[model samples]
Target: MGVTGIGGLFFRADDPEALKAWYAQYLGVAPDGWTPWEQQAGPTIFEPFARSSDYFPAERQHMINFRVTGLDAMLERFRTAGIEVVTKAEWDSPEIGRFARIHDPEGNPIELWEPA
Candidate 1:
């Protein structure tokens, strides 16, 4: 019984309330004072990126990857909500999954993955 799953993800937000609301609206994540959200049981990836990796913005220290289902539907929703979603054909793999990228209002990179 060493380290378990992540307890939470805490980050500095210039406008915490606005960011929370954005997440709630676009990603369906509950905001402050709301019930804690639980993810369905699944594989969670925990890998470190190289300091010079071009996979994401170099200025940011970390990028958050979230497991998702119905990625096409979600992307459509994000587009309808005016959220810019970035995707590349090369990023998808039959062995792994499909991927899409988007930045939060705070400019943090968030990766959405739909396992194959």
Candidate 2:
């Protein structure tokens, strides 16, 4: 049988409740007792990068890339919610698509990618 796509993304949170509420309020992702995100059907990129790859430039070591539909809308939402969203023109690629960066409460890099 062929392998399926990613089932879930689990990570550690200092305060799970607060983190969940933050995500729910901003990104529409509600962590209901560690439930997996109910994402829309679209391309789910699954690839491994070199350990020293500088593709995602961040002070932190690990970065989580999330697929989104409406980048502008999401960016605006984050801005209105008093969240900082960083976008770089150089990060945009004709092949990889548009990308924006944000940080979680614990300062984890989160890449918001809208595939072409």
Candidate 3:
């Protein structure tokens, strides 16, 4: 059979332990060597942007999109936790979804999407 789904996402971090802990504490993502986070089943987008695509930042090589529920609550939580979240009215639609952006301590772009 072909690839089933994303098996893992591995990347380098300036302070790996701190980064791992940050993900675990804020996003509920399991840290390295712990039980892999069990993401709820849903749609996954796998589009390759053009070199000059301005959808996300140009400095970063990749942007990860994580589907979520309760978009408003999550945004509020992030704000209360001192994590800046960016949202645009134009990015949401009845057909697509709502989106918000945040960066990790290392400045990696993360997109949180809530399906419409």
Ranked by lDDT, the better of candidates 2 and 3 is 3
TM-score for all models, in order of appearance: 0.92, 0.79, 0.93
Candidate 3: where is the Cα deviation over 4 Å?
31-34
Model 2, range 16-81, lDDT digits (tens) per residue? 788878777766774575666677777876677776777665455567788888999999988887
How many clashes in candidate 1?
0
Candidate 1 clashes between residue pairs 3 or more apart in a chain or in different chains: none
Which runs of model 1 end up more than 4 angstroms from their true locations?
32-34
lDDT of each: 0.89, 0.80, 0.89
lDDT of 1 by residue, 17-50 (tens): 8999988887877655357778788888888989
96 Cα displacement, candidate 2 (Å): 3.9
RMSD for all candidates, in order, please.
1.4, 2.4, 1.2
TM-score (C-alpha) between model 1 and the true structure: 0.92
